[model samples]
Target chain A: MSEHQYPASLTHGLSREEILNRLHNRLDEPRYEHCLRVEATAIELAKRFDQDVDRAGLAGLLHDYGKEIPVETYKRVIIEDGFDPDLLQYGRGVWHGVVGVHFIQTEVGITDKQVLTAIARHTTGDPEMTKLDEIIFVGDFIEPARSLPVEAKARKAAETNLEEASRIELENTLTYLIDARKLVFPKTLLTYNAFLTKE
Target chain B: MSEHQYPASLTHGLSREEILNRLHNRLDEPRYEHCLRVEATAIELAKRFDQDVDRAGLAGLLHDYGKEIPVETYKRVIIEDGFDPDLLQYGRGVWHGVVGVHFIQTEVGITDKQVLTAIARHTTGDPEMTKLDEIIFVGDFIEPARSLPVEAKARKAAETNLEEASRIELENTLTYLIDARKLVFPKTLLTYNAFLTKE
Candidate 1:
């Protein structure tokens, strides 16, 4: 109910326990481990791209916090958290990201809009990614698990430029989505189109 | 390769076997039976609404003739049959109707543009269905075997007015598609939008 605040880079140097203490029962063990990996990778990739490693790590750590909520609970939270009705069409697997932004605003108590957007679009992906969002998104993909055959090569690409690595990662993910008979989230398509249309 | 030609209705009521003769090897027994039901239903609805009953019946009978082909083969047929690729994303369920129109036009030798369009839009259920197309489209839905609870009421409504009956039928179908998680064919949405906007 308070003004939607997003604390971008909230608790940047906080240890895993410290981060968990703030999020309360919202954190699950396996997902918490994944968040740590995403955060670690984001920092590593940020170093290669000459960006703020701490901010990128912070974005990654919180990107999927909303997903940790149960699916039925996620729907209730989306309504209670206040999101657009069109977002409901995103179905269960992707609805978490939509609700997650609201979670951060209402529950996690963050106030930075850009950081919230990065986490909001972590799953659906946006056409225009802020530098922090791009780093977090790419870092999560190349995180220790998920090990696709080209993971190492893509991770190496991240060193030179996070944007370039993201373009590759997004293309791979889209192709996989098509093969998987999954819904092509419009935001992902828009993001792909965005990059293609960019100078 | 042949010139477009639509099937003509029989002077004597056509038997299922007579209808099957117009189609080639791909027309199976169950589908053929469905076509007969659709044709019969279309004829009855057209008579009640004072539309072109013969055109309605013929279009209904041939609406799905192209469906049994493999997706790759159907995609080729669809593109070659004059469907734009952008309009072809409703999946293979819709591809058949496109191919069926071409079959009617070129192979069967039905040259009437209205009849061709009726066949084309039967599965898709266009918004601005011609007098002929509306009868065929609505008939396919409220046909005798229709198990849906609303079909009987919709069938009776067709007796009062074809266009009004079609509006209800299309809204019902659209709701069903959304509820069932099937993609609403773009043509159907465009048609629905056109009617809503214009009316």
Candidate 2:
């Protein structure tokens, strides 16, 4: 798809350029750009945290792979894959990250369990998260294009402390959901409590 | 306890006077006073919503019956009674309502299912709550002695709409929990989402 060739280091089964091409076809311009920023952000975090930068970048780039998939498709995947039936009540805002992992593994040819887990948890974090998961989660929140004041604070925290950045981002998200009277996915609260109680 | 005799209509298996004596023996002065205020508040809300005032009064008065029990006792009950083991992680703040129903049934001698269910859900509300559950939950938040500005607002809302009041109280509780960096019981979020999406 893209004329560009990606380095082999960043390739997870499929070449990075091939992944970008699929993303371009699937995502609108803005969402595609967001994935790029998240990839860059996650790469920086991975470097700082001593994780595999290539894996982080790959995971971040394809994190929202299923973001633009049709709702009907996601519903069918949820049932067929034996995903939680309760997920049907939520729309793309939640499904894009959770059920999206299916598309990432099968369509994009990324077989790394860690990468898929990070993407699956990007929208609603898990009670126990790996370092890659934290990087992607915070990277998505504090991407350069994000201008929220809370995002700015989280970005500052991400510079030195990934866990603190995650905490701020998670708390801000919960606050926004509660204030707006939006339906909160249960796992988000579980993630919040687990992180806090662990400290 | 005192030289006070409670009305016969408000008795649920146990006489009101006997219940008061047990409460006085178990709870400290402040908690005992809170229970009385909650009872009055629940009664007022019941009258406004045309629910049974006696049931509301009884449920409210005994809602916090386990609040004063030792943490060890609550832990034992959580295990022996087959309560969710995850509940062990939370303190009296959550246990006093959910696991307290057992104590309400056995020790307090209250057998009304509606009354027990209301008390059971007073701390972390259920996804599908009865009118009595809303009454006790809101009563605990908007009781006359509660002076927090949010509580006052919830009290005002309770005067006309129980659902709105419960929403306000739940949101306020969530906000407080997030701000305080406290561990949240997952059911609280479930209750909140269930209420909002139902409307």
Candidate 3:
């Protein structure tokens, strides 16, 4: 509601209220609320992981900035901005992170690379994730509103081992996608493989 | 074994006996035996699927031709022959099929494009596979000696629907790779995603 609600460390040109206004402009009510919950969860995770809490909050809040964009717009931006041509084959489940960074940067006026990269990788994780990235990733999944069965275990794991929580979340996401016959963006698999503990 | 051990229709210049000899020379005894089992399984699948039994048998018999090639050699051939450079990152699990097609063509002297494509796709399947490709793919999984728990279910699926069998096999393979923290070739995920039943 106010500037203090956001992390003081998140000092970009726009106030936290302005960033929320931009998110509200793009996302429907429920999606906007999810972003707030993710922001809260990310701050908690940032504390446990010893990362910048304000940055994590900012990254989480803005992660889904492009979630409501039209498919045609994502396609147009992907082609015009020279994003991977292969990205055209997938939709919002993937584009919101891989392509959404563009929107978060230009629209929200956020310039921090850590926050940007964290948002970019929130949907489909990367082969190597920073501690900040892990916080937003785990926070988004374990945020109180997410009711998936894996959420309980991931939240519990987040209390102790962040990486383990991420592995649980990634595994659950991939399993659901495969079972539902959904098209999986390849980076999800890459992230899954990279996160697995070698046996 | 006698000449009748092979189907009468498999006319690829070299006799089936010569193919067996070549396999024996390159593969360890167990690997060579697996190929024979795959050949038999493929033939049985061919009969069920209304495909040419002899071609399926030949494709199955030679599918793993490059499986035993040294990693160094797989790398060298992948480079020298202008194969997909990405093949260099994966080991025998991938190279044996994608890169092995070249060996089957040159060393084994098998010229059937269908057969070569089947071999090329056996390990990591394509987005669109011919019926012959599906046969070899399922055949190699349901072969009698594969003792993994999923084998029985996959074998049963092969009896009624070869595509279902391939799906089960792909799912099992992917689960194992992810659980074991092994590097999975990207195409394997592509095949798995493409094969899932739409819900």
Candidate 4:
């Protein structure tokens, strides 16, 4: 419960409590708790990486805003919003982030482009991630609730170099998706190539 | 050495000995032997599946025709042939199959559409596979020389059902590629979806 407490300064137009309340209304219990952990972790990462802690916290809190939406709604929003047609081939797992942007824009009224981009890319990261983007992405992967073996190394890496940590996290995620025989989104490939081939 | 001997009846247009001589001249020793084993396995599969044995044999023999080509040549051929622009991002590992069809046509003069298609798809299979294509693809994976444990199951499956064997073989290959952190060709995903999600 103490972890749910947010800093007074961490507000993107709406109070932290208001954002959490909105997210709670949309997500189930476990997902809501995960979002809280991601927010705390993203704030910490942002501090270490010299990014805007408030922006990172907001982005993490709302990243999965569209997760609980009905599949039909997601399909409708994707077409109505003019999202890439290729995304239709993938299932709801990949669509939530894409649909989350529109949801946050209309419902949450958080018009910060950086926050919106981070939310849209939280699931399958984009090739060019801002520092805040890296913080939220790495934080989401290494949040305290997650039990991945690489969590310790990733956390340590984030403290010194968030981009390196983000690369490792994306590599591990791509490997896991492949191992599970899941369909890989093309954007995930672009992200992987961008990270690995970076100078 | 005995494996190098092809049945006289297994010739497409060129004599079996002539085809082997041309293949042997172009391929290194191990590659040449692998091609022979694939041809033998393909012929057996073709017989069991009631496909054209000669076409399968020819396809298997020439499947890797572009493998030994210089990387520069592969790149040049890919561009000249107007292959999917996305293919350039992958290395020669994925390009050999795309370039092989052109090579087989001009260099070896094997103009049989079925044989050429089989060769083109031998690396990363197509969504729509003919019986001959399945024979060559499965034969290349479960050839006598391959030490993979799945080889036995695949060969056995091929005896009873070629398409089923192809699905198993493709699944295993995709898993291995993921394990190795290799870049997966898009066609491989299409082929996987085609088989796994077939009605």
The lDDT of each candidate is: 0.66, 0.86, 0.84, 0.76
lDDT of 4 at A134: 78
lDDT of 4 by residue, B1-199 (tens): 2244444443445666777787787789899888878888888888887888778877887787778878888778778878877877877677667676887777666777878888888888998988788888898988887776688888777778777778778778766665565666767767776775553
Candidate with top TM-score is 2
Give candidate 1's total backbone clashes: 15
Residue-wise C-alpha lDDT for candidate 3, range B1-199, written one tens digit per residue: 1133554444455676788888788899898888888988888888888997778888988898898889998889889988889778788988899888888777877777888899999999887888899999999998998887789899987888888888888887777776666777888898887776422
Model 2 gets an lDDT of 0.86
Residue A72, candidate 4: Cα error in Å is 3.5
User: Model 2, B1-199: lDDT tens per residue?
Assistant: 2223345644544576788888788789999999998998888889999998878888888888999889999999899888889998899999888888888777767777888899989999989998889999999998888998999999898878899999998898899999999988888898998779554
TM-score of chain B of 3: 0.92
Worst 10 residues of 3 chain B by lDDT: B1-10
Report how far residue B68 has shifted in candidate 3, in Å.
4.0
* Candidate of highest lDDT: 2
**List-wise, what DockQ does each model earn?**
0.04, 0.88, 0.45, 0.23
| Model 4 lDDT per residue over A90-171, tens place | 7777787766788888887788888888887888889897888777788888888877678777877877878778777877
**How should the candidates be ordered by lDDT, best one leading?**
2, 3, 4, 1
Question: Per-candidate TM vs. native?
Answer: 0.50, 0.89, 0.79, 0.85
- Alpha carbon lDDT of residue B127, candidate 2? 93
iRMS, all models = 12.4, 0.5, 2.1, 3.2
After superposing candidate 1, which stretches have Cα over 4 Å from the reference? A1-17, B1-199
Which candidate comes out best when scored by DockQ?
A: 2
